[model samples]
Target chain A: MRKLALICVVMVLAFLPPPLLGEVDSALLQDSVTVDLPEPPAPPGNVTATDNPNDNGRAIRVTWELSADDTTGMKNVIGYRINRAEARDAADSLWTEASDILPSGTTEFIHSGDGEEDGPDYFAKNYDFYYRVHALTADTFSVSAVVGPVQAKDNWYNTGVTFVLLFVALFIILTVTFVRIARKGKELYIRPLAGIEAVDEAIGRATEMGKPTLYILGLGSAADIATIASFAILSRVAKKVAEYQTPLLVPCYEPFVMTVAQDTVRAAYMDAGRPDDYDEDSVYFVTSSQFAYVAGVMGTMIREKPATNFYLGMFHAESLLLAETGAMIGSIQIAGTDQIAQLPFFVVACDYTLIGEELYAASVYLSREPVLLGTIKAQDWAKAVVVGTILAGLLARLLVDLDFIKTVFEVSV
Target chain B: MKRQIPMMILSTIGTIFVLAYFSPGLEELEKGGSIFFDVVACFAFFLGGSNLVRVHIQKIARHNPGWGYSIVTLFGFGLMLFIGLFKLGNPLGIAGAPTEPGSWFQIIFQYCVAPLSATMYSLLAFFVASASYRAFRAKNTEATILLVAAFIILLGRTQLGLVMTSWVPDWLSIAQIPNLAVFIMTSPNLAGQRAIMIGIALGVVSMSLRLILGIERSYLGSDS
Candidate 1:
């Protein structure tokens, strides 16, 4: 019986699977021996996630310090991996990989969120976002403690331009106050502009020569401030032409401007007590095409040989062409434009030129109206304030390292 | 009623736009205002086109002194309008862009109008030369200074300034012609430009206020 039982045990042992037979040997080896492995890289330090300021609130800025072991002893670290999760999710929630392989030594990453309504990667504004940085190696990764709950939100007011806003408010108040004072029959003084004085002489010269006075209102629409200012000067010139009985030719580049010019000329004629002399055909629309209008004006100058030419309002490349043609025709030319680039052309080609603000000042100077004169006074005061601020800023920068004064002038929006 | 109503509307719209500029929340209102102006201007183009046609036709009918030129103007205007409006010769028909490739409107614009505009633009070079000759005359102290500045600017823009100043030592680099030209442009020139810009800004502010307050009404052709 003993022999038979031993035989059965031996047979069972022989028939067992190889893995089951090897399990006892593997357990013994694990207990007896241990393999050496390198330690994982240290996690990044001082991780921060914050909303990027002064923006439309579509981004979060993530920053972190390098791990201690990254570039030192062991030096197993290769790069970094950035992970993000919504703050509203669970503490152990699954994180989305924002970047898998940020290069070594990177300390900052700006995670821009799409603001478009239909964008696939759209990130909701004002929602808190959590961020984590992982120090990565060939074999292992060590993640930093999650830096969290930063929400991006839009600011209604850009506090950066507070200084500009205050200055503008002050200027408006000063101008309105002066306008009201002038309306109460108060006389205000404005220095005469040489360009304004030259207008009458140019028109008178045309009268003496028995030739027409050509006025070009430029290519700007009636909504343009320069064009509006030109209308004021045109009113004065039209009145003078009517009184002198000299033929006036006003060619307009814009339709609305033509309508405005016609009304201004007719009013000026009536003001001069020569309503019968006003001709509707005098003020008319030329072609709206820039060069086409230039060609037509050049043709008129060549054919009619106007004695006096007045070029005013906003001008572009056409400025030199008109001024040169007028100069060639031996016409006494007076040009005024607010375009800084075109001013040089006018100055070189025309007899008298209004430089920058002089175009705006010319109208008030020509009319000598108390209300307009008051605005000029207000402008002078504003200019003084600007000059004072500039001087103060210069002094402050030279004397100290503080940037408060400079910041006041730095308009961000 | 005619003058007062327009002035009131101008003032109200102008004030609203000014307010919208400073407030970021009201940015949409600013955009709306701009769109409104563009729409109005588009409609105004019809008025301008009709007036252009009417004036030229009158000159043609009366056999005016420039009647020959009027005929050319009318023909060009009519041709452009017909081609552009119908999108003639466009592969995709009227639904296609007026300036689409191979279209009659595109061909005319590219071959005819473009070259004509370019010719006009090129004439600026001759005008510049003539104007510069007259302006650079050293008749006075300021004119002499201006002439010197112009010469420096012109030379600095070319390789001549660098070749001429190559002999200068590094220690006195500021004395080099090109360096001097740069100094003039970045310092004194920038300062003058800024001053002029500031003056312009203040003038615009005052002028805008006058218009908004109804203080300046000569633009409406009403002295009162």
Candidate 2:
């Protein structure tokens, strides 16, 4: 049979001596490597040097047209080398190489300096320098004409982010207008969120069950916006918890967040007139290591069996781990995060989930201050504008083949 | 006065930060701000470390419910700190990095912490399965649609889908499981995610404006 014969052949090949098998291929490799040398390739053309834009004056941009040999000619050009010097006729040995021979077909290089002052790569700003590129072959190279006397200087403003400036200006204008209206005693309507509505219910469940509520301000530092938003929600939760006199556990991942949470909780208890009952140990610092923190929280959840778990902050990969653990413990869980990737996991595991902007909206909605409401309304209008633009842009691209909107919003780094 | 002073300072510095993005002249100021935060974080780290020790010691002294684990935690924390601070068992001495290869700190991190973190992270695989099972159940109309889509995605990711639909004609290739899966992800899934991202971006801008303008202050604890 063909199968049996193929197996036999494979066994024979596998059992063959390694040297005997490699001999044929090794001969072919040697034949390939003993290639005859050719004349030097054509030199690269039109070398240019200019100060790099949008940076400190530490770099110069060098570019050249590809050699004829690299294109429609012999096609033997392997790569290019860039070099620079200060003098007009510096010795070939004195000119420092900018980088390792750049890979084949490279037409541009950002010749920059870094780290040490006395090193070969020490290119200072505001210096008149000359640059040249070499088109290389196997054994020979042809050099392009030196382009020189170009000085690098820093630009005070990054014109690349002009689109960003425009958007920020528009947003500020819209926000200020709405905020003034709101300050004039107008009631701005915000759609009710299920996650915000469930805050009281989840805490009430914990109160009725006589089990503590666990609040996790996730792994983000205090500077994170999600953590900042969570602080507002936590203040609201703490007020309710204090009024009900329910046991509350807040384990924080960052020390700064922990300190802030302590202040927030203490203030809430003072406001609720229950400062006497607010335990200092109620909010404490956990380990800073990610898994260690998760494990510690998991241990507490298993031991205490808290009736409600509120995870409201910037959770990372541990979103599902925390949520799944809570689900296993049969606790009512309400979670919110701005992380779009983690939303699906939270949606699956938690009883109530706040998706994306809802996390911020919850804070604004809960506070109900005129200015906050005004800002939220402004954000809504911004969203509507973006939606309309997306639709119009799609139509423009499809029917008219125009992409001006795309170009207008494109952010340059 | 206490709150208002800080609010005023926040507004001033925050406005500078916003301008710093577009103005290259403020680039150095931005880096300086970051360096300042790092310096503050070092102090905060000490607070977190001391709190860890104090909380654990108190729990151990009082014989709390999980006092046994506290001892292990303290011992591990103490050992790692001692080894790293002294650079003990490092091939390179004070001149080299504390985390030099074959050093006690690096060895423990590589063998112990890395594996433990990886083990915890790998637990996500099983959790995903369990969560997806609950999520993909056909309890409702939307759930049924999700289950079907998930089924297609699962098949398309493996060799089975190619074998299942390899004979489909070129004109009807879109009906192939792999192509269908790609369409679902790149079309519907991507569209939804982009919509959410736009909303999230707008929210961040609005929230940042509130902070910069001092419209929202509950984060400073009930001040709103």
Candidate 3:
């Protein structure tokens, strides 16, 4: 009985320090060090939040001002610690946990529990929540003031502004440029894109030979933009196949891309008014393992014996294997990729090849969706700006090194 | 409608994040966006892991080809989970902590998983050699130019370039083929790469904007 009593006493003693010795009083017990917390910066202009559409109680979005104090540099200011709480309570009141914490220079937060639903508990039951943000130092010893109680706002800006601006800019530039070229009677020169021009020819050859057109969408995910661009090219090819009444076989490496490609081909067929001819089974997943996927594609090329093959999207080492296999099968392969290393193989093995940016440009060239076309043209403008900047900067460097220019433009250091 | 809503959300969020990069006030929105992505990707890993298990289990049940490999995979999966969860063979014992490197899970990861992955990666060297031999042939002007460039780069990466080019005069230092190769790579090649990269970036931006505005419905398997 005495031994049992002694054991109980020891257990109580072990947990005694955990209870209120006023939560261990780390701050109080430590000598009042001369620690100074940088003052909390002002909240961003137009801070707003709204009920996350298609998400549970997690309101979305908050914006704030980056501190002007550290505009020159943020050596001391590490980041901001954003906190949330019920608006009805005081700032000091045990606040609800922060929805998100961001860097000191950051000014917005999009709080949504959509993907995080199965992960962390990010949402709260009460909609009446307020927000506050504090600056944190590099040492993580200091915190700043709380700013909040801003109600959720759902007002949206007129999105037509973007379209109007784009349309006006694109129309003016393209029309003027083409008109000038026409006036000059200088043939607006376009070097032959072997891949683009040969596309139809390859399909025609396949039709003549009574062989299927092979389409290999590389082992990249649907989320990859390159994969999307490849699908665009695939759409064009599929339509041609429908017109020729030639069989089109698309082998996909990703399950998600498989689903997307099937839909894309189906849509292309429907648009071509040959919906009944669309072969959904033609676009199917061929394992996710990169090498295995390549092997499957190679097998398809050998067995199915496609006369014309299109290997498109981001390729890796498998590019050579697929291209070589297609070449051996006597398929007139027209391959396109943004992957630079694979360009050489495609060029060597394929009849026509699209390299680098040409892959992305191919979709815009084919579809000519006014919006897509406009976007492509707009991108050209951005490219021009970069090119022009570099040229001008180099010229200026060669001529005279201006002080103001040096302050603003010097970036290498 | 189901797909439309998600597409709309994606477009809006993606656009907002892009804008946040430029505008100082919208910075928090971007941070939140990154956090959201991290959270989403993390959760999606679970989905991927579950799918992996499901596919293998189905294969085993069906007595499919490579079913033994599936069994091995599942065994590995279950064993790793058990070892990590229980912290088996931990020096600290059950009362202390997990993930202390002395644990069996850590041991297995260091001994088995890391080495296997590294070995697989090292196979790329052999593959590259084979690929180069098959792919590189001076068939035409373009091929010859590529071949020359390839030779220069390959030689420049080795000590042979130094030994071969040591006779080059100091005043005509750029005449050294290896140095010229380096210059070419850093100048013309980098410039071309940068230009293409810029175009790609802009293309991504435009495509993102389209997706954000719900203008690109092809991804959703819908016209509207």
Could you say which candidate leads in lDDT?
Answer: 2
DockQ of each: 0.47, 0.44, 0.13
lDDT of 2 by residue, A1-413 (tens): 96576556556655788776665455443443454445789999999999988765678999999999986598989899998888868899878888788977889999887424798666676889988999999889999998998987766777788877777788889999999999999888888888888888988999999999999998899878888889888888898899999999999899888888988888788777888988877888887889988989999999899999999999999999999999999999999999988998999999999888889778777767887788988998888888987788888888888667678777765
The digit string of per-residue lDDT tens for model 2 on B1-224 reads: 75688679778767877777777556657667767777887798787788888888999999989999999999998999999999998898866688999998999999999999999999999999999989988999999998999999999999999899999998999999999999999999999999999998998888888888888877565443
Query: What tens digits encode model 1's per-residue C-alpha lDDT throughout B1-224?
Result: 87889789889888877866565545545667778888887777787787778887888899877889989988998999998999999988999999899999999989998899889889999999999999999999998999999999888778999899989999999878889899999998989888888888888887788788887777566543
**Number of backbone collisions per candidate:** 0, 0, 12
lDDT by residue (B1-224, candidate 3, tens digit) is: 76777776787777776554333335447668767766664554454456557766876899865577668777887898788778799988775456676788778877986676565445556555665775578888977877888898888878888789989999998868789789879997888777767766666665665566565555343353
Residue ranges of candidate 2 with Cα displaced over 4 Å: A1-42, A72-76, A89-94, A113-125, A271-278, A403-406, B5-9, B159-170
lDDT of 3 by residue, A1-413 (tens): 96576556545554776565455435533322323333443333344444433222345565666654435444455566566666635656667556445665787776544225466654543446666655555554233344455433322332323443454355346534543544555443333466788888999999999999998888777667778878878888888899899998887776667766877898778767899998666776555667656655666687679999998898988887788778777899888887777777777677888876677767656654555555555556666766786788777877897665544443220
Ranking by TM-score: 2, 1, 3
Q: Indicate the TM-score of model 3.
A: 0.59
Candidate 3's C-alpha lDDT?
0.67
Chain A TM-score compared with the true chain A, each model in order: 0.66, 0.83, 0.56
The DockQ for candidate 1, computed on C-alphas, is 0.47
